[model samples]
Target: MAQWTVVRAQHPAELVAASHLFDGPVSHDGAADALARPGHVVLLARTPDGRDVGFVSGVEMRHPDKDPEMFLYELGVDEAWRRQGVASALLDALRDLARGLGCQGMWTGTEADNAAALATYRRAGAQVDRGSVFVVWDELDGEDVPAR
Candidate 1:
């Protein structure tokens, strides 16, 4: 198995440096904004040789009547690192961080057809809320959004 280190990204440079792990090009200003936000977090996983191989981003959500919970926004691993425990490690790291921050729980959504993702989350001890539906409103600017 390959060895890697996972660390919470502390600066925009760290996030921008791992742009390839994202779905699209990472904007430096956007990274800066996210890091500046009070409850946003980005975790990066890097190989022993310092190559970024994966990332997980999350936001801490708080409600007036409940304790804070982490909303896992996204997780990505380089194709080369899939099925090698990289994704599970990233999820574990995020869960640890959430616990440290006093979050009551953590949650994320993934397409039902994504078997790899489902397996990874299950391995990380996540319970599926099978009846929950994922809904989104995108491209409010009138541009047509492509289906994933």
Candidate 2:
């Protein structure tokens, strides 16, 4: 039972401050660019003392024939703070945000071998779409794209 507050990041400074929660280093320029985009969201879970312990980023997807849905981009929690419901809290916050934005649904992809991620998502009420497969273009213009 850890005590933390979940907040949507409205500023690049907020994202930069919580950079460590990201898989890679977050640059000020990148953070600013992300914040400027519509339908992109970044939520931070911070301790009472102002330490960022977790984060979840999502993007709203729109289709001409369908209502918008949220695509959960990434989720991370400080290793030391794991197993304390931090990730669940972050997911809950993101889910609430999606509902607030009128999204019809939310989805995310994780490797089949990632047991921890699967468990976390399942605990948050996510159902496995066994028929769904994730495909990616890891390379473009003869250069390898870094995995997020």
Candidate 3:
């Protein structure tokens, strides 16, 4: 059995241990600068052998008409470690972190076609908002998205 260490990283150096688990360059100085800011959070999972296996990143959001909530930005696990509870554990840890930060709730979104993600979120006790639709405006792709 592999023991896992789940932690909320407050500094880039603390995140270096699980840098490989991230898809992009998130352990550099620029990333450190970003992590040092308020709202952003990165929760990492390390194996007993000291290998980084998974991570979940989130942000705290506040609005004029609502209480604070956490937006789960991303979640990923190493291919070899999939279905081994890494994702769920990371999410649970993030929920704890969110509550500690006084967030009233936490939410995340994934494509309806992403079975793995939907399953993981379900296992983590997330409710699906079937009535909501997700849309994006890709300005960098040169597509014009008109205001609704």
Range of the 10 consecutive residues with the lowest summed lDDT in candidate 3 = 137-146
Per-residue lDDT of model 1, residues 6-125, tens digit only: 988988988888999999888899999999999999999998788899999999999999999999999999999888888989999999999999999999999989888888888999
lDDT on C-alpha atoms for all candidate structures: 0.91, 0.92, 0.84
What is the C-alpha lDDT profile of model 3 across 56-131, one tens digit per residue? Answer: 9999999999999999999989899888889989999999999999999999888988999988898888988888
Error of 3 at 107 (Å): 0.8
Residue 146, candidate 1: C-alpha displacement in angstroms: 20
Local accuracy of candidate 2 as per-residue lDDT tens digits, 20-111 = 88888888899999988999999999999999999999999999999989999999999999999999999999999999999999999999
Off by over 4 Å in 3: 14-17, 140-148
Candidate 3 achieves a global lDDT of 0.84
TM-score order of candidates, best first?
2, 1, 3
The residue pairs in collision within model 2 are none
Estimated TM-score for each candidate: 0.91, 0.92, 0.85
* Index of the highest-lDDT prediction: 2
The residue pairs that clash in candidate 3, if any, are none
Better of 1 and 2 by TM-score: 2
Q: Relative to the unseen true structure, what is the C-alpha lDDT of residue 86 in candidate 2, on a scale of 0 to 100?
A: 94
Over the full model, what C-alpha lDDT does candidate 1 score relative to the true structure? 0.91
